[model samples]
Target: MKHLKEVDAVTTELREALAGAGVVLPSLRPDPVSIAHRYNPPLVELGRCSMEVARRLTAALTPTRQSRGERP
Candidate 1:
């Protein structure tokens, strides 16, 4: 729980910095298979990074949701 809170704090700070830079972060939603199929190197790199973060967040949150009897 402490680690989660620390990670959240770091994420918040990073987001604020990005916002101050006028950089709009893209959605981290998993790309549809059709869309992912069209990516070249740069897009692929971005997609991979987003996917990794999304996966880690999902994994961390899932158990907490289950503990609360929530259907995610």
Candidate 2:
């Protein structure tokens, strides 16, 4: 039960973080297999998104020139 809660918290955190970056993973959630009380640690399912969303996620993950202290 504790593990499940923790995993859920993680999922929520990730969702909020991604939203902050303008990235919304529609199917984001905890992996059922991993959260079946069979594993100590749970896995997060990012699910699939459109190419546009994927590109946006990649851009968010990547540091831009300005973010790296360089002029664009």
Candidate 3:
């Protein structure tokens, strides 16, 4: 739990980012095992979402005219 706060902060930030893109990760959390060890940095587990969520996420991540402040 060394980086507990840091992990939570990052997880929350990601949630907000996803929210801005109309995405929701129902089971977002910090991986306990990852933080427990000292070998690697803590990991934020996005957990699971539906196909629609996947598609939306992909769309948000992908470049589009709207994202670039362009008009159709």
The TM-scores, one per candidate, come to 0.36, 0.90, 0.81
lDDT ranking from best to worst?
2, 3, 1
Give the alpha carbon lDDT tens digit for every residue of 1-72 in model 3.
558889999999999999999999899999888988787889999898999999999998999998789998
- Candidate achieving higher lDDT, 1 or 3: 3
Q: Each candidate: what lDDT?
A: 0.45, 0.93, 0.91
TM-score of 2: 0.90
Cα error, residue 45 of model 2, in Å, equals 0.6
| Clash count in backbone of candidate 3 | 0
Candidate numbers sorted by TM-score from highest down: 2, 3, 1
Candidate 3 whole-model C-alpha lDDT, 0 to 1: 0.91
Displacement of residue 67 (Cα, Å) in model 3 is 5.2
Which residue pairs of candidate 3 clash? none
Model 1: CA > 4 A from native: 28-72
RMSD of each: 15.0, 1.2, 2.1
Residue pairs in candidate 1 whose N, alpha carbon or C atoms collide under 3 angstroms: none
Select the stronger candidate by TM-score from 1 and 3: 3
Better of 2 and 3 by TM-score: 2
